[model samples]
Target: MTIRRTVKRVIDGDTFEVARKIQGTNRIRIAGLNAPDSNQKGYSEAKNRLRRLISSKQVTIVPVGRSYNRLVA
Candidate 1:
């Protein structure tokens, strides 16, 4: 299913939070993106880039699966 919502926060390079009416806040993981982890180099850069690209913007999500608490899309 395709879901459209405003991005509420950037969790990292490949994950972000979106507002949901019933769920409160939902975390989304960009499918196929292998961004660096917090301990790795370029982690901040990747996260900043992602944040700049989608911060406060309404984005379309097509969830493919779930990883922990995040919806992979």
Candidate 2:
């Protein structure tokens, strides 16, 4: 299913939060990509790239699976 929502926040490089109708505010991760953590090198670059890609944007989240509490999209 495709859910329409606004990007709420970027947690890191690979994870973000979205505000949706059915799920309210939830976290989602881009599958199959591992971006660096906060303490790692290239972390800023990765996060900045992701921010420039999706910040303040409306996105279509197609949920393929779930990992614990976060949805994988």
Candidate 3:
């Protein structure tokens, strides 16, 4: 199912958190994105780009699966 929620936080380039009021989960992983890890080069740039794109914005989430505790979309 697809849902819309405001972006609460950007965890990294490919992962983020939505509003807590939504059901199921708030954490979400962007599917198919292989962004730089925390210790790697360009990590901050990638994360910041994502933050600029989605932070505090309402986004559509189409969940495909679950990884760790985050919903993959």
In model 1, the number of clashes is 0
TM-score of each: 0.95, 0.88, 0.92
Residue 67, candidate 1: how far off, in angstroms?
0.7
Answer with 1 or 2, whichever has the higher TM-score.
Answer: 1
Every candidate's lDDT = 0.96, 0.91, 0.92
Per-residue CA lDDT of model 1 for 1-73, tens digit only, reads: 8999999999999999999967789999999999999999999999999999999999999989999888999
- Clashing residue pairs in candidate 2 are none
Each model's total of backbone clashes: 0, 0, 0
Which candidate number has the best TM-score?
1
The digit string of per-residue lDDT tens for model 3 on 1-73 reads: 9989999899999999998673644899999998999999999999999999999999999999999999999
- Lowest summed lDDT over 10 consecutive residues: which window, candidate 2? 17-26
Model 2: per-residue Cα lDDT over 1-73, one tens digit each: 8888899888889999998677768899998989999999999999989988998899998899999699999
Q: Is candidate 1 or candidate 3 better by TM-score?
A: 1
TM-score of model 3 (CA atoms): 0.92
